[model samples]
Target: MNPQIPDGLRELLALAAGAGQAPWRTLLRPGDWLLLLCCAALVAASYPLLWRGGVADRAIVKRDGRLVTELALNVARKYEVTGAIGTTVIEVQPGRARVLSDPGPRQYCVQQGWLSRANAVAICAPNHVTLQLAGRGGAHADYDTINY
Candidate 1:
């Protein structure tokens, strides 16, 4: 069905479209544009600080789906974990940890490199080993899923 506009409303629309009056000025005033620019600038400056992950204070190691050990991030050291397949070597330094060597054929976890931020994780699927970084309070409660 065709919808019809009332005649008075149609005439008002036509006049506002410059059909029978001077050309219209923009609806936005200078103050409106200034407010919009300020809001955009604030968001741009704050986005990175708020979204970047927290500082990691320790590394949690797991093997065969069980907790193996927790290494403090304040001291540099290397650890070995026995997993389903073979041994996986982990290295830890101030505020970071990474899989230094893994028996997994793909070596994906070793290639993951340093995990400095809270909630960072590396998994050696073939060896059944996992390394996770956490802050003093542990993993962020707000995140639903984190990918490394």
Candidate 2:
């Protein structure tokens, strides 16, 4: 049997054995560093645009396509909103809100759990109800990636 090293492996071995300077110093040029810095800056800039965690102070509850009422999240309370199908119990705590109960067959809104972030929404399509968290700007606050 005959054994032979591949051309790429042979070249790699030669480079590793003969190189005097450090591999990073030789591999990374000024332009490479500048590119890396630019990429890092782009990533840093995208954070604010992509991840929006606004301060939510209230929740806006809508039913049957009309504005029903606004509930303050700071004061914990439960409000029953009448929708097309039935009543939906909305529970609000400090900086958060959720659908405690819904008359819809599929409890998608109830299963959504707590919503504490601005622009976070829980929609009960069957009941035509929507519960959305809002900041001081109301529902006009900048939306997060999920909402956008």
Candidate 3:
């Protein structure tokens, strides 16, 4: 049997092999370091928000123009669904009820789930619906206060 080789295959192979021998610093530029730092800072800033429940409030769920259920949570659970008719389940921790609904395809709303604290939301895409938790209508005057 005869073996066929492409014209530039030898040069390409040599280049690839040489790459592994180069100093590691040659592969990382200043921009790469900056990007790594920025990502680290972003993750650091988000840790508290993601792990420590920021607030607490009542979460109301509605489906097809009717209220289905309500819950309270320390944080929202993220989920997704897609179909003609779909069901959304909301499980609240520390003594809360689960809200379920039938939503059509493009379950964007299901992705929004429940955010027990600030910067959290539940959304249903196909139905163009959302479920969220917020503070009571009145009686609050603290910037860092969280309602349990």
**CA lDDT of each prediction against the hidden true structure:** 0.84, 0.86, 0.52
lDDT of 2 by residue, 30-103 (tens): 99999999999999988974555487888889987788999988898999988888899999999899999999
Off by over 4 Å in 2: 1-53, 138-140, 144-148
lDDT of 1: 0.84
For the record, the alpha-carbon RMSD of candidate 1 to the native fold, in angstroms, is 5.9
* Global fold similarity of model 1 (TM-score): 0.62
Candidate 1, residues 74-121: lDDT per residue as tens digits? 999999998888899999999889999999898989998998878888
Q: Please, what is the TM-score per model? A: 0.62, 0.61, 0.35
Candidate 3 Cα misplacement greater than 4 A, ranges: 1-54, 74-84, 95-107, 110-114, 118-120, 127-129, 137-148
Q: Which of the two, 1 or 3, has more lDDT?
A: 1
Tens-digit per-residue lDDT, 52-84, candidate 3? 444546665555545655555545452332223
Candidate 2 yields a Cα-based lDDT of 0.86
How far residue 33's Cα lies from its native spot in candidate 2, in Å, is 24
Which pairs clash (backbone N, Cα, C closer than 3 Å) in model 3? Answer: 76-114, 108-123, 108-125, 109-123, 109-124, 109-125, 112-122, 112-123, 113-122
